[model samples]
Target: MTAIILAGGKSRRMGFNKAFLPYGDKTFIEHQIARLNKIFDEIILSANDARLYAHLNLPIVSDILPERGPLSGICAGLIRSTSFHSFVIACDMPFIHEKIILYLREQIGGYDVVVPQTSRGLEPLHAFYSRNCIQPMYRCLNEGRLRIIDFFSEVKVKIVDEQEFKELDVPTQPLVNLNTPEEYQKYCDYKAPNQRES
Candidate 1:
């Protein structure tokens, strides 16, 4: 299966591009690639700013329907993926667990999407999508329904429950994503203590 890193968000809430934010020793994009590369051989990036990500040395595809949000990005990635199923995630999630990724991949068969459902809601960006979703996604985009999960009823979706996610991502860290400056700072500060101890 391929791994699709959705990096084309406007970052309006963040006030700056979170994709460039520092994660460990590398930038956020680099950090993601290094980890995702371990599980999937084909890793593609879905972003509008192709030049900004050219240095990453992976196939970068712009959204098929630009500015339409993550739904469009997911559609584009699914179309470009060589595999039947692709693991799609946003760029700002720095704490994505590898074990969770493998678990999702293992659950892909017999469903068009394998998504984690927490008490909060469905984590669409952090889920697995089958190429079978392409037509339904495009239909949703054409109908101007941009919500990521708007087309769920049209497809076979397997919802991995909160307990399953918590087992792999202990304490259920809420899929920490850097959407605002405060959240980014909090992530950095949280990592500081562990980095120093290491």
Candidate 2:
């Protein structure tokens, strides 16, 4: 199956693209793509700017409907992907474990959307989407309904429970995102001590 990464975040909080943040020896997106490429057949990057993820030499795509946030990116990926099910992840999510991703992929069959449910809510970005979403998504876009999870009712959504996510040591991070300089620095310090690369 294919994996589509949403890299169009405005990053108003971090003052830069989250994907560019250093993690271990590479940028977070580099780490993410490298890991994802191991399991997925093809990797598609959906972003407005081509400069980002350009060096990776993977297929890159822009939102079919720009400035519409992740929902728009997902729609574009659904249309572009050849696989019946496509895995999607947000660029800001730095700690998404491959184990959870593998589990989610296994649970994708027969569902329009396969997402994890945290104590807070659904982690839509770290999810799987079926091609069946194209029309409903198009309708949602045309109708100006831009929220990513707004169409959950229109499709068969499988909410992967805590049991599955725990294999990734998830509850500790379920969705670790860096929204500020301090938090980014902390992650950098943890991942790369003594200024040494992992």
Candidate 3:
């Protein structure tokens, strides 16, 4: 399977590129790539500007529909993906564990999408997408239906609820994403002590 990182967001609330934000010893994107490399053979970066991530030496794909939001990025990734199924995640989510990812991978059989639903609701970015969803997603983008879940009804969506997550000892931390400076700072502060101890 392949891994797709969505990094094309405007990051208006962050006031800077969230992908470049420091998580521990590495930048957010770098950390994600390092972790994903251990699980996936191929990793595709979905960004608006390929030049920004050219140094990473991965396949950086720009949105085919341009600025249509994450749904557009997912479309681009799925189009470029060599695998039948791909694990998609936003760049700002730093706590996504390998166990959670492996669990999602196991649930992908005969499903177009295997998404997790936490107390916060459906985590579209942190989900698995199949090649079968390509057309429905493209149709959504072409029709200006930018919401990620707009095409869910047209596909075989297997929603992994919180109970399922608990069975695997998975917590909501994996779905916690930093969208604002305050959230970023809070995470940094939370990790500072752990960093020093290490």
What TM-score do all the candidates reach, one by one?
Answer: 0.92, 0.89, 0.94
Tens digits of lDDT, candidate 3, 16-36:
999999877889899889889
Between prediction 2 and prediction 3, which has the larger TM-score?
Answer: 3
Candidate topping TM-score: 3
Note each model's CA RMSD in angstroms: 2.5, 3.2, 2.4
Q: By descending lDDT, how would the candidates be arranged?
A: 3, 1, 2
List per-prediction Cα lDDT, in the order shown.
0.84, 0.80, 0.88
lDDT of 1 by residue, 1-198 (tens): 799999999999989888898876877778778778878989999999899999889999988887799999999999999999999989998676677778878888799999988777888988999988999999999999999999999999999986875566454543567789888887764442212332
Model 2 bad stretches (over 4 Å)? 167-174, 189-198
Task: Write one digit per residue (lDDT tens) for candidate 2, span 30-96.
Answer: 8778778778999999988988678889788888787777888889988889898999988877665
> Can you list the residue pairs that collide in candidate 3?
none
How many clashing pairs in candidate 2?
0
Model 3 — TM-score against the truth? 0.94
Supply candidate 3's per-residue lDDT for 183.
92
Candidate 2 similarity to native, TM-score: 0.89
Of models 1 and 2, which has the larger TM-score?
A: 1
Clashing pairs in 1: none
